[model samples]
Target: MASGLCENCSQLRELTAHLRKVCREFERKIRNVFREFSECNCVRITPERSFLRTTQELPSLRLLNDDETQLLSQESLQALNKLAVSENTGLQMSAAMHYLHLSHLLKSPLPDAFMEPVMALLLSTDLDVQKTISLALVNLLVKNNVCKELVIEMGMLVPILELFQSGDSAAQCHSCACVAMLASSESNKDAIVVDGIIPLLALAKSYDPRVQQNATWALLHLTQSDGSTRILCQAGAIPVLVLLLQSSDSEVQFCSCTALCNIAAIREHHPKLLSIGGHYLLKSLLTLMLSSVQKNSAQACRCLQTLSKNVLIQEQLMELDCVLPLKALLKTSAAVWTEPAVTLLSALSAHPPNNDFLVSEGLLDEVALLLHHHRSSSAIITHSCVIITNLCSSRMGQQAVMESLCLSGLLGALLSPGLSDETLLHVTSCLNHLTTWSEWPGHPLNLSAAITAEQVSGLVKMSGQIQNSLLSCNCAAIISKLEMTEEIIGLLRPHYITMSEYLLVFLKKKDVKFQHLGIVTIFNLKKDGDFSSLLADSELEVELRKVHAQTEETRRLLQMIQPLSPSSVNP
Candidate 1:
C-alpha cells in the first residue's frame, strides 16, 4: 500500500512539471504577441491598449486565439465605427485601420459589416479621415476579394462617386483610384460606365492638377472597353484634355497626352478626335515641344509622335505649316529636342502624303542646310543626315537633295575615320536613302557616280573602326543603294570574324531601330556575291544562324512608313 501511494505521488509530480512547462510556453507566446502589436505604436487608444494587455496577459485568452480571430475582428469593427464617427478619435481610427491593413487582417476583420461605416467616413467633413477611410475600403476590397456587388449592395457606390466631386483633392484622387480598381473587374466596368463615369470625368477636369491627373488615369482605364472611346468623345473629354495639355504641371500634361495617345490608338476614334479639336491640340502640343523646360518639351514631343503616326491625324497635320517649328526645334540648343525633331522631319519627309507639304513649306532646303552645317557633333550630324535622307526619298526631296549640293558633305562625313559609330550610321543611312530615291523609275537625279570608287576607298580606310554593328549596317545600306558588291566583299574579307561577332551582338539589343537597321544591312550584304564567300568562312556560320533567326522576325514586321499629318494651328 505504501508503494502504491508513492507511485501516485510520482505521477502527481510529473503532472505539476508538465503544467509549469505549458504555462511558460503560454507566457512566451503572449510576450511575442505584445511585442508585435506594440511595434506599431502609432495606434493610440485607451480601450485598445487594455484589450491588447488582456490578450497578452492571458495567452490562452479566447480573444487572442486564432479561432476567435473573427470575434476580435467584430470587436475591432465596432471600435472603428464608433471611432470613425467621433471627431476627436478619427485619427486613432485611421491608425487602427493602418495597423490592420499592414497586418493583413482585413479578411478576418468582417469587411462586409464595416462597409457602411467606411462609406459614411468617406463623406466625413474631415479630409484626412475621408482619405484614410477610402484607402481602407480599397484595402478591404482588394485584400478580401470583395466584389463590386458587395459595394453596391451596401449602397456605397453613390457615396464613393460623390467623393470624386469632393473639394479635397487627396480624397478625390483616392476615390478615383478606388473606382478605377473596381472598374478593372469586368463585372464592375459596365456598372461604372452606366453610373455616370463620363460626367464625373468632366467634373474632375476642373479640379486641382493632381485630381485631374488621377481622374484622367481613371478615365483611361475605363475607356479600355469597347464603345467607351465613343462615349468619352461624346462626353466632351477631348476639349478638357486639350485644356489640360496647357497645364504647367508636367505630370498633368503627360497624363493628358497619354490619354490622347490611347484615343488615337483606336482606329475608329481617330476621326472623332480630329473632329473634336485634335488638330488644334496637336499644334499646341508642338509649340510645347519648344518649351525651355526639358520635361515639358519631352512630353510634347511624345504626344506629337503619337498623333503623327495616325493616318487621319497625319493628313490633318500636313495641311498646316508644322515644318517651321520642327526645323527650329532641330536647330534648338536643347539636345533633348533633337531626336524628336529628327523623327518628325523624317516622318514628314518619308511619307508621300507629306512630300508636297514639305516642299511647299521650303523644308527641304532648311533640312539640307542643317545637314551641311551641323557636323560639329556626330549626333547632330547623324540626326540631320536622317532628316535629309527622308527628304531625298521623294521626287521633290531628291530634287532638293540634288539642289542642296550636300551629298558631297554627307559622303565626306561617312568616309571620315574619326566619325563615331552613330555618326557613320546616320551618314550612311542618309546616303542610302538619297541614292535609293534618286534611282527610282521617275527619279530626278542619279547618285551612281556620287558613291564611286573614291567613296569606296574612303569607306575602306575606316573599315577597322566601322566594324561595329551600327556602322556595319550603315555601310551595308549605303552599299546596297550604290550596289557596290565587290567593294563590300573586299571590305568584309579581312574582318569576317569581327563583322560576324558585332552583327550577332547587335541583334540582341532591345532597341527596335537597332534590330531593323541590322537586318536591313544583312539583307543588303547577302545580295552581294561576296556575302556567300563570307558565309562560307567557318567562324561566321554560328553568327549567321543568330542573324538569320532575327532577320526572319524583322522581315515579318517590316518597317512602317508613315506620312506627316496637317499641322494644327495654335489659338
Candidate 2:
C-alpha cells in the first residue's frame, strides 16, 4: 500500500512540471506575435526585440503598441543626429525622420522631451527633409498652439527663412506656408520680418508657380500689419509683386493681385505701388477682368477695388483708359460680371476725374441701357442703379446721367413693387442727386423740374412702403433735397406717432446728410401743434442739435480740402 501511494505522488509531480513548461511556451508565443504586429504597424518595441527577428521567415520585428512607437521615434532621432554629420546618411536620415513624424501624427501629443530633437530636423542638409519637417512643425504648432513660445524660443527663424530660398518648389511652398502660420501672431510679425522674409521673397522670385503662389500668399499675410508693410516695401516686395502680375499662370497672377491688395491696404503703400509701374500692370489686370474664368475675374476685380481706394491709383487708372474696359465689362452678356463691374464703375464714378471720364465715354448711356433693357438678377440691377447714383452725384456727371434718360428708369425702379430694397435705395439716391440739378448748361430747368417731381413722388411712395434702413435714408435725402417739407408734413399729420418714431430713428443715424434730412423733415412738420408735441415727446429736439453739430463739423472738414499736391493728384 505504501509503494502504490508513492507512485501516485511521483506521477503528480511530473504532471505539474509538464504543465509549467507548456505555460512558458504559450507566454513566449504571445510575446512574439505582439512584437510581430508592432513592427508591421511601424511602432516602437522593447530594445531586446527591436532588432530581433520574430521568425526565420520574417527577418524584422516590431513593438506591440505605443511602446513600439516611442522606441522607433527615439531610435530614428538618434540615427538622425548621427546622420546629420555625414553627407550620405542625410537622405536616409531624412526618410527615417519623416517616418518617425508619421508615427508621431498617429499618436497623441508627444512628450515635451521630444520637441528639441524633432526641431533639430529642420536643420537637415536634405532640403526635402527640411521642408517636410518645417511643414510638420507648422501643422503641429498651429494645432497645439502651445508650441509658439517654445518654437520662438528655439531660434528657428533663420533656418526656416533659408528654406524659402530653396530651389525645390515643394520645399519652398511648404517653407512659406510654415512661416506664414508662425508669423500669424502680431508679436511674431516683427521677428519674422527681421528674420529676412522680405529679402527671401526677392530670392524666391524664380521658383515654380506653386512656390510663387505660396510665397506671395505668405507675403500678403506678413504685410497685413502696419509695421510689416513698410518693411516689405523697403525690402523691394512691391516691385516683385508688380512683375509677378504679368505671370502667365492665372493662379500666380491672382495671388500677386491679392498681395498687391493687402499692400495697398496701407495708405502709405499706395503711391509706392503706383510709382513702380503698378498703373501699367493695372491696365493689364483690367484686361484680364474680361476673362471667362470666374476666379481670375474676381481676383482682378478685388485688386481694382483696392487700387481704387487710393485717389492717386484711381486717377492713374483713369488716365490709362480703364473706364472703357470697365464699361464694356459692365455691359457684357454674362450676368456674373455685373456685380463686380458695377462696383468698379461706382468706385470710379465716385471721383471727379473718373466721373469726367465716364461722362466723356458715354458711360451714363451704358448704365441707362442696363437699367432700361437688361433683365438680370435683382442684385445686379441694384448695383447698376447704384453706379448711376454715384455718377449722378457729381455736378458734371449728373447732367450726363439725366440727359441719358436715367431718371425715367430710376423713377420706375423706385416705384415698382417688385424692386428689391437694394434697388429702391439706389434709385432713391439717384433721384436725390438729380433733384439738385435745377439746370445744366445743355439742358433747361423744365426738364429738371419734371424729373424732380416724378422722382419725389416715387421716393415718397417708397418711404411709406420699404422697411430697410438704407432705403429710408435714401428717401429722406431725396425729400430733403426736393424741399418737400409740406408733403412730408401733410403725410405725417394724421399718423404723427409713427412718423415721429421713424424720424427719430433716422435722426440718430451717423450719416450726416440723412440726419440733416431728418431735422429738415421735423422742422417743416412743426407747423402742426400735434406734430410738435410728438416730436418733442420723441426727443427730436436733442437729436436735431446733435445732427446740427455733426453737420458743422463735416462742413469744417470739407472747407479744409486744399488743392491736392501734384503727387496726390491722379492726373
Positional deviation of 20 in candidate 1, in angstroms? 43
Task: Write the residue-wise lDDT of candidate 1 on 1-571 in tens digits.
Answer: 4445577798998899999999999988987876777555553356555444433334322333444354336565565555555555444455335433533443454546655566667656766666776776666656654666677666677777877666767778777767766766666666777665665566556547766766766676666676665777777777777777787777777667767767766677666666744467877777777667666666666566666776555666666666666767766655565667666666555567676667667766665565555555565576567667655555666676677667767865655546666667677767656665565455445554555555665554433343475555556455445444455456545554554555455566566665555555567666756665676654445655666787677776675545355664333
Q: Point out where model 1 deviates above 4 Å.
A: 1-128, 135-158, 165-170, 180-191, 223-227, 277-279, 293-295, 309-315, 331-340, 353-390, 393-396, 399-571
Show pairs that collide, candidate 1.
314-565, 316-566, 317-565, 317-566, 317-567, 318-565, 318-566, 319-566
Candidate 2, 383: how far from true, in Å? Answer: 6.7
| RMSD (CA, Å), each prediction | 17.4, 14.8
Q: In model 2, where is the ten-residue run with the lowest total lDDT?
A: 54-63
Candidate 2 accuracy as lDDT: 0.65
Candidate 2 to native Cα RMSD, angstroms:
14.8
Q: Candidate 2, TM-score vs. the true structure?
A: 0.59
Q: Would you estimate the TM-scores of all the predictions?
A: 0.52, 0.59
